[model samples]
Target: MIELITATQLDYFDNLYIEMKGDAVERDDYIVAETKRGFEMLRVVKSNYRVPKDNIVEPDGRFVRLATDEDVKAFDKNDGMARESLSFCKEAVVEEKLDMQLVNAKYTLDRKKLIFNFTADERVDFRNLVRILANRFKTRIELRQIGVRDEAKYLGGIGPCGRAHCCSTFLGDFVPVSIQMAKNQDLSLSPTKISGACGRLMCCLNYEDEYYEDAREQMPDVGQTIDTPDGRAVVIGMNILDLVVKVKYKDDYIREYHCDELNAVGEV
Candidate 1:
């Protein structure tokens, strides 16, 4: 697997999977390259971007050797230009009264293309806006409309967990999340409580789902009838994390017992 820099101090691009030959590339090697977007300078990364054998995609271009001092200077200049281009795009959006929120911008390493990212509630007519930016930058201009989740992934911030967002830091691609996952885990259905910064179900829900699912299948659920050492009882509560069930006896006494201690008679 070949690696490429996904982000820089000011710009964020999806980590690209490149196909390179021989031992010419190594981790942290800076090189000029052409990507699907345009010409770019990407550094090799240690982690691989894996793909299924059936639908593997090829790299845009081959690595063009390790970077030089001149390449470093060129990248620095491009970085500064990208920031300025973002500012310019924002002003243009305002002037045109476009229904869009500009997110970020990037300039290709060869300065032949400028890409702008934005989010909007609905489709935006950006034909005129593109012409404005094209004349200003004197290059091919692309305005990409993305979803809220993608916007969050691009401009990251602290999550509800008081740490960096998973999307920006480590998540390579987003997986499907559903509210039922929360219900299965017995979480509060409150949207504000369960949703993430992306305003979708917290991705962490998928992390331990298998464990909860297996435990639920193997154990009796709350409100189910069960036979306990004390007597016939109804399950009152549960701690899935601890693999324990709290039961209320016919005498109205409640006791927590290991899952194995209770024999399931029937579900509620």
Candidate 2:
């Protein structure tokens, strides 16, 4: 009996499945005699823009070669994973009908559970969708909906920045960011200038919001009249990052001063 599948095993099976199915290489197991080669972990997606150039799963966990018709029966008795996979496929049919795509799907070693990964433009009403899958599959079914940011991370991509996208490369989860953070940082209000490829405000904004707020506390608001060494002037703008304020004085002369110096000169 093929005890466990290795990387070579996954690779061989993947190649065979790809060749056999052409444009539709759904994941499959390969039967092979164990060797020194490693196995890779694998996940199923509706489709991938870039297919793996090599093997999938690592050889660390319990694995085996392709199951023959007779082997399948024996597997059903001993392996819960095989049993669950069949149910997952059935559930996928209905889920596919509802969404047209599934992102990441996986099953447990024991055929006790199935997980579906997906993305949508807005909230999805899968009440009927879930019931149909549950009754037909006869096992646990879970559907996880993710955002485009999460999708980009799941599939992986080069971000608008020089490095890989944060969501994909390293950010396991997203932090909240807001437009006010941009205003605090004195960033251009234009969406494109501050937003990430995800079309949301950059996650970096959250990082500096506290500092911006602290700085704003030290500085006074614009349009407030305040005294300067030269003369009194109306505050026109604030430099949040530098903690400086621009004061408009006589003859249209404008100068920025430190916040602490505002009180030293005179009252507003």
Candidate 3:
């Protein structure tokens, strides 16, 4: 049977979906998969489940088999080596005086490639550094430049909400988040309030943005004049979720009324 296996590599934490023709696998089980990068050892986050072929386009890769004891030992050894390589790369960066922050290093399952992920503000010249790393590791070297958001995903942290970072947790992909989303939700425009630990607009802001956009269309904006049962009132505030608007009448007495109970007259 074709089952969906959600797995991730220790080197790269992003969850990947793989289709396997197998009975079933439990969560946290180690499995081998053939990916574009080559054979990779992946830890299952979600167990195998039957998925209709018509539902999903295709999985990221095809699963090979469950990892044997020898495979696990090799994976552990590779992880240790990658960590050591990262430390050495960091020292090399310091010595070279390169303006880049090394985030992680990893070796492919076959030890054919050593990949390094780093973050830099501007264009970096790392030809000399690459040569140094190639000589030290005695393998194919790959230097990847990543953004701050991807770096945060690599190095997980607790966000301002006191929870683990979404990117580091279950977020398989990063969606586009904009300042307009914050505005649509009537949130304060403060960067500190809206930005995530990665210093980018919070991904959660996109979660309820569609709902708020629909609510805004149904509700009148603040400072708009609307005809209420009491009289013509100026909208002072709004509860978008509840479709409730607070309005002030000619006498300056404010009252709350549902959007359905009011008629839009015009802007105040």
Candidate 4:
């Protein structure tokens, strides 16, 4: 069966794979479907492989089906249905362009829908630009404003950790992330350190945030003055996973102890 994995928007993010109940084709292979996000070629593998099924991976939810080429073509024919667009503001090195990276160039198949995908630092004024594209395409047009992460998904690049970009590779939706998650994980506050190419906090930070929170609750705060092996001292640092705390006792003297040695903590 041809499954359709549509992005909530054409942000070039991963889309969900739908395994519709009572599906006619229960094949051992996965089929490809086209959404505004591009194309998804998914195949079914042995459940014993232990790879997550459906949207359990992240940003879950997509519509699966047995789609025919005719179905895709007809949807594309609706000019305004599937196309997204972006209008150029000021003249650039290329041409008057909107804030979009051209993933595909040239119009084919009678210009089904003119979809504009762009990222803007501030609210843009592009009424006249839209008018220009509408007249040029002679069909319906759509403009999609995406975040920095979406652009990374559209362009496809390697991440700082030497892995494929997560937004495009597996993630579908941009789950909420906060700096607090970073703080809980003890990540650097620098934007470049924690933020992804999308200029937003990395999605990974949320993975262990709850664990950190739970761990923190079981132990004393880092700055609290607590009794330790060396002596009564103030906690200078902590390791949540190791359940260890560093206490500062005397001049330039610090000691590390597991939570098991911890005693009643005094006020900082």
lDDT of 4 by residue, 166-197 (tens): 77665656789999998887778999999887
Q: Give the residue spans of candidate 2 off by over 4 A.
A: 1-97, 105-114, 122-142, 266-268
| Top-lDDT structure, candidate number | 3
lDDT of 3 by residue, 1-268 (tens): 2222222132222133332243356777777777666677777666634555585544556567878898888888999999999999999999999999999988878898898999999999999999999999999999999999988888889998899988887786689999999999899999999998889999999999999999899888889887888788899999998989999988989999887766443333
TM-score for each of the candidates? 0.85, 0.52, 0.84, 0.62
lDDT for residue 63 in candidate 3, whole number 0-100: 69
Clashes of 2: 19
RMSD of 2: 13.9
- Candidate with maximal TM-score: 1
Worst 10 residues of 1 by lDDT: 8-17
RMSD of each: 4.2, 13.9, 4.4, 7.4
Worst 10 residues of 2 by lDDT: 1-10
Colliding residue pairs in candidate 1: none
By TM-score, the better pick of 2 and 4 is: 4
Ranking of predictions according to TM-score? 1, 3, 4, 2
Put down candidate 1 lDDT per residue, 175-198, tens digits, no spaces.
Answer: 888888887788999999889888
Alpha carbon RMSD to native, model 3: 4.4
Worst 10-residue lDDT window for candidate 3 reads: 5-14
